[model samples]
Target: MKKKFLGLLIFITTYASSQTYTTNFNVNTNNKDIKSIVDIWQSYLKTNSKEYWNTAETKDLKNFNILNIEGVINPSLMNWNFSNLILSVNLFSEDSYLIKSIFEGENKSVFAITNVLAKKENGNFKLSNYLFDYTKNWRSHSSENITYFYRPDYILNVEEVSQAEKFYSELCKTFNLKSEKLTYFIAKDCDNIYDILGYEYIFSKGMSKECGYYEIQNNYIFATEKAGANHYHEITHFINKFYPNANYLLLTGVSAYLSGEKAHFGKPLIYHIKRVNEYLEKNKEISLSKPFDFYKLDENTNPQYVIGGLLCDLIIERQGKNGLIEAFKNTKSDEEFLQFLQSKVLKKNENLNDVLRKKIKEISKTDEFPNRLKN
Candidate 1:
């Protein structure tokens, strides 16, 4: 879940005041566990979530209370300023509980819901995530680049670790970052991803039973097997490590460029390009630069991926990674990014949309197998 461009999520018409955020929930407030949780949520509602975590801060357990907001999310990026209200709480056990809530987001039409686990911590209940708890019984093996987490019943073969190590080493060279041990949580499917990330379920971004999500600030990679051991998409996010200034619209494309594949959809970049080409053939006049929501190419495919990926491919092929590092470091605005492209590397790409399709043609002929990995 890159939450890149158009990370817009749900909004219900209902609204609530700060003190009322936890007032209406039907949990047993009299219980110490519930009371502790109520205090946590009330404080969260009263404060702007942005105050809880900074994407650029150096994260550590000692710093977690100040930085890692929760096991799930910092806040909805678009709805960061929106209000949240607790609707209900269900006790899963004396120590574990489920919470449901709505965010009265900036958008008023679409519906969004969020859920988190509340469990006793140090004898005081706090809003929590199941990431570590869910993995308490899981086994792990360390590699040169990755620390793999999965069920003991699962076979994490040697090939997987080798491939993951190769991807990590390549990305380290690509980013010029000193190599550090990576924390990877590999799972059977996206449900494991959601549960590990402090979600019972999430409705705002819509759910995919399979996907890859990167929590870069904490260096956690939640990926399904479909994402593969060499998941350059989410891996790119962690390796980059510089999120505050990341042009995510471009970063999303960069992720596509590096990963060379899509999770869940489980297709390669060229596979998606062929699908988008079919979409373009139907609407010949459609513009990729403009508001192109024709994302319905498939249930899980997003157009930015293929188009952004191609654009990234073009920039890299034309001017190399340093060129991209230039654009990434300096270009902040989307329009600014395009302007940088036009000024620096726009030879055959003057008509960006057509060129993206043309580039796909160029790639399809020789790139059926992602040659980038072979390098």
Candidate 2:
């Protein structure tokens, strides 16, 4: 944790150049294991193939687990957006290693660091993930709907555990889908979760340090919140599974609609709507077309979630559950989505942005936003 790559100097001049591609593989001497490590890594850098990504992991696991865990997939040093890459290898044993990659940004000292574990294999080496090794010592608790994993030293929130089980059943019943046991992992803070999963320090584009990801197919959640099964925002992510054929982005809106910042994190979706409205008022030119702003004015909030939730609110308000399901299952393209929104919410002459701003402002005035799931 706290960026463990020590004594690895990054020369900033290379990052200042244009589209310059190279690999700085640093190793002390020529040993068989080190040779294999260099060979496998250089091969990966050259072809950027899936073969390398797959075999680089431990015997029974794939490196893609890290992809699902961290949400950062770097296949090669060939990214056009970054200036240069620095790769350092630290061998824990002849059979184990931790590979750290520091991607230097062109603009400033800002760089993104990612990690992978290299294990010696058949006189060579393969890249593995840090997750399984990290979680081996952790404790677990099983309920009717969740299998919870946590650090041994952590105090289990039994109340939240019960709430999580209750919420899971409620959500399943509301969506008319069978409830499945979710594999939920908890950490004290997000940064701790990152550390256990091979992330050191991630610069949040100079914003808040909030970051986390979940494995949808596996129904695995790696979160920092003690809310566990009671995690409303994340539990609502199951809507995608219920409507597998639905637009995923819209399903995310559904999740944001149900929980957003409330249910455990305090503020409601209306809280975000208010802050975003203030942001819209000051920016003046912010349009509905650009509704997915990553730099959303509120803490850990963005426009896509806010706008889309508002759209969900309007759809359900006008059309109810069946109509909302229709939009979820049928609305595929952005064109279709906009037209659907236009038909449902737009007044005679108002543009999509105009209507969206009005709804956002109206919702902001209320202390609480309507959650259809609660019905």
Candidate 3:
């Protein structure tokens, strides 16, 4: 009976020591002992089970779910396997630490940076909140005004960054606009983009694969390909901040005009212009008068973008740059923009609808029109 009791006591001691839990350390008294707390958090990350996570604080559980979905489950669904976990911790505040975790995977991997906030209650540190900065894991390169974040495997070249900055400056000068610091996020591929943006939100919106997208709210540009890097098209969207309430048609039109239509595809502007002309020729029933209604047209059949570009070009040519700027500043809707063009930009007696079609036909006949490919 004595030997049995001794053996049971040893087993319990060993098991209790092996189990990891969060450590509470008083900042004023035990500042140097914070490593112990970090160690416990790291151990919990590696060894904790789903049941343990389920019972954890709601904020921590929510963060864990985000990391699991984006970092683990989504990758697994895409045939990637993750391993080789690396965790780095830095003290953020008296009760919080910043944790960065990088995992190596067979197909692809993720690096996650999250702020782990804790509270001391009953002599134990309990997780309170987790605020995540998804881009923290990306490698960053910056100029004076622009910060570009990219994957480790794919990095932006110095020339590309320099050119992007130069173009931004030029756009500011051209538009008489002020410049602001910009952040660019370049994904490895389309799949990786879905990782940056939560899978459900992107897929649910029916967003098709494009080279890049400009997020106006966040002031960030998300790109899937190298061509998407520093494109004037996306930059134009940002510069349009000067005229927040401008007509959508005028807004996109000016961007299309200044940036050119083939900005993403690397073809000359003429390539897209010609494609639009061919589209117009094939479908004569379509009128450029209702350029705003071009959204109703099929994606392949839509000539609105090219039409807008040409119309903007015409406005700049006839009304001058100052006139175009005035229109952008004053026009609030598509109807207002159209009326502005009729009353101010174009000749007073000429019909507004005929001018655009006539210009399209004349430009289509020019040698500058691209004939090799449709798009």
lDDT of each: 0.60, 0.62, 0.54
RMSD of each: 4.8, 6.3, 17.3
lDDT of 3 by residue, 15-110 (tens): 111222232233222454345445544555665433223234443333343333321222322122223232444566675554433333332223
What lDDT is reached at residue 284 by model 1? Answer: 80
TM-score of each: 0.78, 0.76, 0.60
- For candidate 1, write residues 1-375 as lDDT tens digits: 332332332223323322235445466778776666666766755663423332232134323322133223434322344455666777866677766665554443323355556666555556554455578798888887688888777777778679778877877777777777677888878766665555544553345645666665556677787665666677777645554554555676677777655522567777777767777777787776542233445555677777666766677778887777776786666667777777887775477666776776666566462533235
Cα deviation at 268, candidate 1, in Å, is 0.7
lDDT of candidate 2 over 43-132, digit per residue (tens):
655454555543544233433545333222222224324543436667766568766665565654645566667776564566666776
TM-score: model 2 vs. ground truth: 0.76
Looking at model 1, report the run of 10 residues with the lowest lDDT sum. Answer: 62-71
Best by lDDT: 2
Of candidate 3, the 10-residue stretch with the lowest lDDT total is 1-10
lDDT of 2 at 171: 76
lDDT of the structure predicted as candidate 3: 0.54
